[model samples]
Target: MSFPRSATRSALALAGAGVLVLAWGGSAVAAQQGSTTVEPAGAAFSATLDGEATFETGPITVTCAVSASDPGDGNNLVPDEPDNHNPEGAVGGPINAPNFDDCEADVPLVDVEVEVADAVWDMSMQDGESAVGTMHVPAAGIVVTTSGVASCTATVSPDADVDIEGTWTNGDPVSSLAFDTTAPIEVEGGVGCPDDTEAGFTAAYEVENADDADTPITVGP
Candidate 1:
């Protein structure tokens, strides 16, 4: 999916409106026992980068100054089955493709470009006191292209799907979805890029109801 760019936006301008929802809109029925649900189901959301997005592979670092989760698709939180441990929701993908802008490499004169894959990769959201969602790019993973003084290709391909971990605050859907992981987002590179797989990615986003900005998504069971 092409990430629809609406001029350049700062993550601050649209904070408190970020969430990854199941692609297949679900019923708002109360969650079943033992099921972790991202509540207020059947709603879409808006998300802005809580801060700058960063990707690092050893000494090389790339940062995006802005990013947003595209709006639409009636995305919402379904009950249980997101299996935060496994990171697989019932079906294909989060509601929108996240878009990034003003990305630059920390290395002088080197430029950075990132692209999320186009295939359907399942996502899993789980509630553990707070909330956690896991996502994985298709086999292609997320491609980071570096150009300018030098050019290179790097891919952050997780061996398994539904594995990128994102966390939400306890009962605070308005808080940022924390995407910093204990483990690096493992990467493989070529053409002057690092040969080892020690890449890391981190971003924070706040989620709000697309239909009702004042309403925050909640977790149940």
Candidate 2:
């Protein structure tokens, strides 16, 4: 489905050469749990969500969501058990038809686990190394990038929720930060480069600042 104009704003409220922002209120960005102090241009800024900034000819939209559900009826696959001790095995059949409990024993519930690794920040600038922001989800998960040139990072451990460990400098820095999804978490949405607006562009995506039903990203010019 196409993104609504409001949703578009939520995803593009911040854009720049190498922007860095902290998680706002309770949204879903990785760095929302903590906060990032803004710095001067070319200054050091660290939050979450990293890798080199990629440029695009036009505006690009990325849709992301996390979901899980109880096994529910979908968990049922095997048939009802029968009285093997009795010689008469013709009283009832399978749940749907002439089948039997043999099928029920094979049913298994498949759990759902989702992880969003990297988000792309489109702007103009070519660089091999620079500043970096890394955000971690409060759960054990993996990071996956839809568009960009970077590694798919973040693997939440089984006992830890997600959280950004720290930001880094790109010019040959330590490994990227990873999110933990299997434990208690305190943060949600955040921005790595809120002040770093793209050249000639004032509008960019942002996390939901408040609990109102308004758009998440606020566009400017």
Which candidate comes out best when scored by lDDT? 1
Per-residue lDDT of candidate 1, residues 1-221 (tens digit): 43232332211110112110001011121221235555555555566787777755444455677766645543333322433223332222455556667765533444445666655544455555546656544554455554443344545554544356676663354745677652323433333333444445677777776667666765544
- What TM-score, over all chains together, does every model reach? 0.68, 0.17
Cα deviation at 62, candidate 2, in Å, is 8.4
**Candidate maximizing TM-score:** 1
- Least accurate stretch of 10 residues (summed lDDT) in model 2? 96-105
Question: Could you tell me the TM-score of candidate 1?
Answer: 0.68
lDDT against the true structure, per candidate, is 0.48, 0.20
Question: Going through the candidates in order, what is the number of backbone clashes in each?
Answer: 10, 56
Give residue 203's lDDT in candidate 2 (0 to 100).
Answer: 13
Per-residue lDDT for 145-187 in model 2, tens only?
1112111212323244333222222222212322221222222
